[model samples]
Target chain A: DTAVSQTPKYLVTQMGNDKSIKCEQNLGHDTMYWYKQDSKKFLKIMFSYNNKELIINETVPNRFSPKSPDKAHLNLHINSLELGDSAVYFCASSKTGWSSEKLFFGSGTQLSVL
Target chain B: AQSVTQLDSHVSVSEGTPVLLRCNYSSSYSPSLFWYVQHPNKGLQLLLKYTSAATLVKGINGFEAEFKKSETSFHLTKPSAHMSDAAEYFCVVSVGTGTASKLTFGTGTRLQVTL
Candidate 1:
């Protein structure tokens, strides 16, 4: 079974469009995170949720918001997506909120904003 | 705060040759370090992690890393290289306290192993 899974492995959308990426983890982890991999392949954390509560919020634009309905799911919604938003988004989860815990990552979703 | 730097952006090696990917880190407190491998179009996979454990930590796929506090380094090494080992490797560090803790990833190093 895939421990961490994200839907729509490839997404192509036009500028100013709204899109959402769904993520689910069956690892029974309490902490989930959203990371963005830019064109340079530099991964940066965007948001983190522990037990359905937002714990960490980076300097991401207000157009992007993460919603966690429960401990098992964390979804990212992007509003008025711009060309710069074209990048791979990864979903990850860990056993706890501790940084020492190893993370399980999904295959990643490639979003292209034309 | 904590951060990790991967010295080499790309490294090429021949089969059976030794492999070394350099990494340096800076942190205000004791840190947790990790090495992750990412094959093309795949998710990142944990190779090994060091969390106040032995200085020499061994991981799967015949990979290992040594944590040197004085040098502030956790470099991944392998005695022999296999073609299948070609991938992008990332050095990561996690620091801070409580639930506020966060992980910082290096730019990544692409490894090319030839037969």
Candidate 2:
């Protein structure tokens, strides 16, 4: 079974379009995270949720919103996406919210805004 | 504050040759360091980690890293490079110890191995 899975491996949309990326993990982990990799291949943390509660929210714009309906799933919703939003979004999970735990990542979703 | 720096943005080596990827980190507290490898279109995979345990940490795929507090460096090294080892490697540092703590990832280093 895939430990972490993200849908829509590739996304191409026009400017001002809204899109949603879904992520699910079957590792029975309590903490989940969303990371964005820019054109320079710099990965930055966007948001994190533990047990359906928001724990970490970086300086990402309001256009990027994350929702965790349950502990096993964390979804990202982008509103009025801009060209700058073109990058790879990754979903990751750990056993707990502990920083020391190793994160299991999913095959990322490549988002391209035209 | 915590941060990580990958010395090289790209490294080229021949198969069966020694491979080295340099990394430096800074943190206020005893930091947890990690090396993650990402293949094209794939997720990051854990190579090795240093958490104040043994300074020399060995990981999968014949990779290993040594943490040096004096220099604040945790460099990944391998005795022999394989073409399959070509990927992007990232150095990561955890600032704090709790669930709320954030991870700082270094600019990745792309490794290219030639036959």
Candidate 3:
């Protein structure tokens, strides 16, 4: 069984379009995170939530927003997606309270903005 | 703040040869270092991690890393390179104060294994 899963493994959209990517983790972890991998393969954390509460929100554009309805699910919504938004989005989860806890990542969603 | 630098953006190795991927890190506090590998069209997988424990940490698939505090380096090494070992490797550092912490990832090194 997949520990962490994300939907729409491949997404092709146009500029100014809106899209949402759903993620779920069954590892019973309390902390969930969203990371972005650019064309250069540089990974960066965009947001983090612990127990469904927002904890770390990086300097991402306001167009991108993350919502965690419950501790098990964290979804990302991008409004008016731009060309620069083309990248892979990875969802991960780890045990809470410790920062060094190892993360279990999903296969990732590849978003291509045309 | 914490950051990691992967010295080589790409490294090539021949089959049966040893592998080395260099990494350097800087953190305000004692850091938790990690090496993660990603195959094509796959998510990043944790190869090994160091959390103020043993300097040498072993990971899955015959991968290991040494955490050197004096040099602020956590370099990943393997005894031999296999064709399956070709992938992108990321060096990560995490610094925490109390209950809050963050992870910083390196630019990643793409390892190429040739026969």
DockQ of each: 0.84, 0.84, 0.70
Candidate 2 is graded, for docking, as high
Best by lDDT: 1
lDDT of 2 by residue, B1-115 (tens): 8999999999999999999999999998999999999999899999988888999999999999999999999999999999999999999998665789778999999999998
Worst 10 residues of 2 chain B by lDDT: B94-103
Task: Tell me the lDDT of model 2 at A67.
Answer: 96
Candidate 3's displacement at residue A36, Å, is 0.5
lDDT of 2 by residue, A47-87 (tens): 99999999999999999999999999999999999999999
Q: State the TM-score of candidate 3 restricted to chain B.
A: 0.96
What lDDT is reached at residue B100 by model 1? 72
State the TM-score, rounded to 2 decimals, of chain A in model 3: 0.98
Which lDDT tens digits does candidate 3 get at residues A1-114? 899999999999999999999999999999999999999999999998999989889999999999999999999999999999999999998889376789899999999999
Docking quality class, candidate 3: medium
Candidate 3's residue-wise lDDT over B12-81, tens digit each?
9999999999999998888899999999999999999999989999999999999988998999999999
Give candidate 2's error at residue A97 in angstroms: 1.7
User: How good is the docking of model 3, as DockQ?
Assistant: 0.70
Ranking by DockQ: 1, 2, 3
What does candidate 1's lDDT look like per residue over B59-86, in tens digits?
Answer: 9899999999999999999999999999
Q: Which segments of candidate 2 are over 4 A away from where they belong?
A: none
